[model samples]
Target: MSATPNDPSTPNTPNTPNTPSTPDASYLVDGLRFAFGTLTVVPVRVTRWDREAARGGMLWAPLVGVAVGAAAALCGVVLLALGAGAPLAAVCSVAVPAALTRGLHLDGLADTADGLGSGKPAEDALQIMKRSDIGPFGVVTLVFVLLGQVAALAQAYGDSWARGALAAVVAATAGRLALTSAAPAPVPAAPAPRAPS
Candidate 1:
């Protein structure tokens, strides 16, 4: 005897009113699995809890920051210990954290600068940020940011590479967490597009 339309175990048949979605199937489950797999890298946990977890779906930016910073420090150590050139070490040190975090904070910095830098109304400022191009204010801010990082790394000195590593851990985590805590406003789903400033 064959199972009727009421039988959910059947395969390749279009689900109808008779059969309901399974409790186990869900987007949230898939997302959670993906997030755990990407962030914590625990393959076991990924399978344990699932649903297409994109963005790494981190619960806290500070944890992400500390992890990124530690990774950067390790990269720095590798370069320095391997006798890589000073420039190479410096570049790698900076890049490790930047790349590890996938540059979200930097984008935040750039956008915030763009929005606030524009003298126009708040809506217009936000529009400037959505655009692909950067304004003069953006360029200036980027330069200063680069310079400041370079200066900080340089000032960290040979003996302080370890401290630089610690600082990275402390600074990124503390700063990101602080920003997150301070953000009282709710995020809008989408913003109106506007011409570049």
Candidate 2:
């Protein structure tokens, strides 16, 4: 006996209510900003340096290596094309990444050497590592490691410039992988999102 309800049909409703129909562009932009900001000396405006952004940055670290490696490879290739010797090309190739990263990894290497050379307790070793001055161990380690890298790269370049470039890419990617894997979890948590300006 109830009156018939008015019938209505709609075909435009989204299957997921809270989700955006289109992909969010901001996240990709943020990830790229964080990646370049954290990994290289390139200038990029990063509005967020939070835990979420750090996680995103970690995911993109390998991409940063791709860029760095490409630049290094190009340098090597150009040197080879210009009839430069393999050793010179190799040295420049090694130098490219160092210049780009501002020798940050070299600093870490020096710190580690200093810490190990101290042979002190963990606290004292850490304190030694924190010093700005390079110790004997650090000096020796840097010389040997850098020489080794140049020698290896020169040998590879002797075989083929392409081989040297490929090696650079692989080494860069592996380095970034190590960095990502060694990062602590939770990323210290991000600060609260700021109010819109």
Candidate 3:
């Protein structure tokens, strides 16, 4: 899994034959729109009140949603400008971004539903997430979520597509982040109690 100097394609890697590829600026820009989890970094420069938890690493998550919405609006306009039918534009608009992220949020969404919604104890629930198998909950959720996304894209088609895309990204990021926030952080290693004589 480790990239080495021998491989020219390694990202941010030094001493390589190939120049590092530049990440898509819009992707980077869209990522900063979050309040937690630093994966998506769409920077908005808006003031955020200090959070009580360890939410500092990701201050852009919410902004991603806002940005996605904005992106969606932009996409809509561009689609309209291209004069391509609404269906084509809507499909193409989201294809690149979704492909880039590799549908990570969709997987997470499925896993959360399967693991948390399963009628089992907490330990068993945790076990489900580790398994690769999908359950009824994951399937149902995936279907409806994708449907909702498509519907949203269609609805926002006539308007600003850029803003709409940004909004969609934000929605996806925020939903997953909420899933993340629901889980408890691993407990600190407990100090061993001294054995009494």
Candidate 4:
């Protein structure tokens, strides 16, 4: 006897009409969670960690940038409102993004610099990057890069609060957009073959 359509004994066939072939609303939500959970110190619970979720996360990662940028701009604006000097406000603005991201970006930058500066083979460079301690190259890169960011922000703030805030938001958003654009799409896993009935 043939099993009924609603029968529990029926095996699920591949590419069936009942199968969901496209991402649903929940997929987008999962992506959003992944973006915020991984990108910021914001307390978001990511429910999924698979390739589909990662693809979703990458799609939504730019929104995390917008949030970080806005928060950083707010910090600089608030400091300036309290009569803080342009340099001080700039420092706070630059600091906010670093704090929000738990310094991951800066850490990556340092690691990359260390790896490249080693002038080693790919495997050796990767090993250098994986080390816990920062090398001399990492230290120097962090110092110069941070100084440059502070200096640029200070100049913008000196001009006006609006300009400074705009600069902060633009910079942060652009950085994230660059990451998003450069990220490789996750390849979906192939479906397993059905067992012989």
- Which predicted model would earn the best TM-score? 4
Ranking by lDDT: 4, 2, 1, 3
Model 3 per-residue lDDT tens digits across residues 1-197 = 86743243565343432222333333333333323233333333533232212243243444444444445545655776778755555665565445434566667779889987898886688778767888999999988877776666766654655545555566656754664465336443234567999
Q: Give the alpha-carbon lDDT of every model.
A: 0.58, 0.79, 0.55, 0.85
Displacement of the residue 9 alpha carbon in candidate 3, Å:
37
The order of the candidates by TM-score, greatest first, is: 4, 2, 1, 3
User: Where is model 2 more than 4 Å wrong at Cα?
Assistant: 1-24, 184-197
- Candidate 1 positional error at 98, Å: 2.0
TM-score of candidate 2 on Cα atoms, chains taken together: 0.79
Candidate 3 Cα outliers beyond 4 Å, as residue runs: 1-54, 64-76, 93-97, 159-197
Which candidate wins on lDDT? 4
lDDT for model 2 comes to 0.79
Scanning candidate 1 in windows of ten residues, the lowest lDDT window is: 48-57
Per-residue C-alpha lDDT of model 2 across residues 17-56, encoded as one tens digit per residue: 2112432466556767998887889988998775445766
TM-score of each: 0.61, 0.79, 0.51, 0.83
Residue-level lDDT of model 1, residues 1-197, one tens digit each, is 87654344655233432222432243345444554345443452554331112322333445656776677667766777787644555566677766655565566677778888888887788778888776777778877886677567645535466766666567667765664465445577346567799
Q: What total of clashing residue pairs does each candidate reach? A: 8, 0, 53, 0
